[model samples]
Target: MLNRSGNTKYQIKDAQQVYRQLSVSYEKIDSTSKKLVAFADKCPNIDENDISSKARYATLCRNIRMYAVQVLQNFSLSTRRVPTEDEIKQARDAKQRSDNELMEKVILSIPGINGKTLELSEELKPFIQQYYQVLQYMQQAKLAGRDDEVKLLESNLEELAQAMRVAHQN
Candidate 1:
């Protein structure tokens, strides 16, 4: 009887640990998803003729969205509680709405800059600012055990660095 009780206690502790991990993962996924959506929304506007630049911007947004979806799926599967189809659809719809609203706000704020050509330094300014912001957020995400966010920020930093290098080269 004593051995059985001991086994029961151990099982309970293990279950608690699993629950805790799931909770933490869910919270991280939620927070990082919001950040990804916001970043996508705030992407800088580029000239209409700059097809390559627009492609790069679109790729970045796509990558961010993919990351968010991947994180959500991975966490849900790991917790052994896959979300329903309706839940997944709802999350995607919410993301779409948020992206639309944010993009509208960004477009309205930068009305005159659409077709204008910016100097190298003017163009690099936003990347530099974003680099610093990502660095700060990366630190906080690390402390919070938000590995998905950290990975995303690290990738953003790498892209910013490459962009700056190219800008300097030209």
Candidate 2:
């Protein structure tokens, strides 16, 4: 029984060694990607088979590098640290500025607001006020454990802006 167990342990180690040998290294992948990109750039036209193959190889190399970086990042996630004072301050300042700009844009779109000529309906005033309130809440929420929520809000704001653009165009 002991002999079988010892053999099993050796087999596991050997498998790991083989796996590491086959896996791509970050530097090797980056070098290969650069070479492929150079080749692609030198090609006369993008429709050529050689250029296509080189582009595919370059994309593969980039994926390999990205996988390696993600693995490293996952390893670091286990020992993640809180942001330093400077980082926190910088993030806060950026959030404040972004929120200020967003507020200006939204208000300026309304008639009779921010020197804009479009008159807003009475029904829209409450919604606009609520929007500013939500923005204020998010600005203050940045200091709390709400970074992820703030990011969601920012994404939604982007979608809202796109919708507004479409509405205005129509």
Candidate 3:
């Protein structure tokens, strides 16, 4: 059997590996979320009945949910103990700020798409707001060590994912 120090070292290495994987996953999800939002902005006037438009919209919604889930999972893994209320609030604020900056960048990146971008942003506002709200709740639950609440929130997210998938079914 390994000595206590050797065992601890192995555990630390395993955790570092998991952290790296989670970081990579978060980056991919963030990139996909930004691309989807950009696509929405560029195609604001897309015909709802068009198969491609429906597929793209569904994909965007799915990506948002996927990003939220990954973020919650990452938080759950990274935190060693329950966080204070202040910490939770700080995390929530930071995430919102980051999201707003991303939105601004996405909007500014495509010139002459203002009207379309506005329309798309307006149409998606409810969904986007609700998704983020759920994500915030998930973060709180995870930080509080409420596994049951986390599972419930995950179920809600999965339902949102299913709705998006069904909306684009051919």
Candidate 4:
């Protein structure tokens, strides 16, 4: 490759080496694609009325609990010191997405799930948003070294966690 100043810039010194690497990558991708398709095909379709299908729903609710309190557990500034803004943003997005996704998945996929559970999932969307906002506020308080505010928010988080359990159980 030539530079703008008419200087030689050795972009790819061994063209054959690049070709070999690409061929290896292509083979791996093809193998992985076939495996993924085979795995998906082997999984049985979930019917909401089927008792066996409740297993996945149980797993999903377990994940919801994990996501609900994920930030509070990770953002313990006292344990690990300050998290980067990027870390906070990613955590925040996950927390927000977690709540919203509960309703979406329940509504779209599990029609035979209890009607009350579906409605509760829908309501939990905004509740999940508020849960993380308090988390953000708690993060700010921790940074400010205002233990008072942080403690209060910790209690609030506990309450939110309880509500989350209630919602998921519904």
Candidate 5:
């Protein structure tokens, strides 16, 4: 948890851990729901249709509340100081590597849909241009310390590529 109030700052690892916890909770909810449905079906006197939707809703609500509580507890434990300048530098490098991997997959794979040839023609040039725009926005985000904005721009760019492919095909 990165707190705007007080002096708390979260490292990237902390954010990743929170996200992982959320993922695990979602999986747990899915498994529990499946089990409940199976159990309801096994009851001889009860039709699946006779099973109360309210029970399902209540269980989902309880699971969500538990997830929220866990997240809050994690945040309460996340009162560490801001990362040192060196740690920040390392984080930036790691982020750059991750971005490079994603860009290679998402941007470079967009046609004139070549995976790695990197040749540009009239058709492919527009894709490259859009990618450059995304890169520029990402650079600005880095300077402004707005990494999430950069990721949003990347997602938008990826969507634009998909739209372009559809338009070109049509």
Candidate 6:
């Protein structure tokens, strides 16, 4: 019987309350996990009657599961998408690796095309221009139903790969 806007507002209020409760629960879980691990570490795992009770066995299982999580990944308690510092570093590292690969390609392509290998390298655009142009033309040739041209370009690319290999060795 409520209006659409009123229902939406009520749902939003309910969601907010649920989120608050989840936040509080996460804090408790985080604290309990730490304390439980400490307590488990103190308990004798090998003794005959050390972890005899069901509750102690349950604690051991929880401790092992948490240990696995800690070892396997950067664990987070937040339900939302929160970027941790490690995640940011990983993203930056991946981008740097990609850039390094592209630069290596440009360097190899230049030597293959008989371009100058100068001490001070030029910009990425000029270095990769000819390589991209040839690649683009080859793709267009294939799409235009030019099988002969495609075959020719494929062989040319193979030759280029060999040349790049030679250049890489040097």
List the global CA lDDT of all models: 0.66, 0.57, 0.63, 0.61, 0.65, 0.60
- Give lDDT tens digits, candidate 3, residues 1-170: 37866763334446666777867877677777767666764566678669787677767766786777678677768756545567768999999888876555443333333423343344444444555566679999999999999999878766654443333232
The lDDT leader among the candidates is 1
**Which of candidates 1 and 2 reaches a greater lDDT?**
1
* lDDT of the structure predicted as candidate 4: 0.61
Residue 18 displacement (Å), model 6: 14
Q: What is the overall TM-score of model 2 with all chains considered together?
A: 0.28
Model 1, C-alpha of 25: deviation from truth (Å) = 2.0
Note the clash tally of each candidate: 0, 1, 0, 0, 0, 0
RMSD of 5: 19.6
74: Cα error in model 3, Å: 48
Query: Which pairs, if any, clash in model 2?
Result: 111-118
Q: What is the lDDT of residue 13 in candidate 6?
A: 49
Stretches of candidate 5 above 4 Å error?
A: 1-112, 116-119, 167-170
Alpha-carbon lDDT of model 1: 0.66
- Report model 3's TM-score to 2 decimal places: 0.29
- Give the RMSD in angstroms, all C-alphas superposed, for model 3: 30.5
Q: Give the lowest summed-lDDT range of ten residues in model 6.
A: 118-127
The C-alpha TM-scores of every prediction are 0.31, 0.28, 0.29, 0.31, 0.29, 0.31
lDDT of 4 by residue, 13-52 (tens): 3554565665566556555555544544244565656665
Q: Write the per-residue lDDT of candidate 6 for residues 90-131, one digit (tens) a residue.
A: 999999788667655655555344434523244434435445
Candidate RMSDs in order: 32.2, 22.9, 30.5, 27.8, 19.6, 14.6
Assess candidate 6 and give its lDDT: 0.60
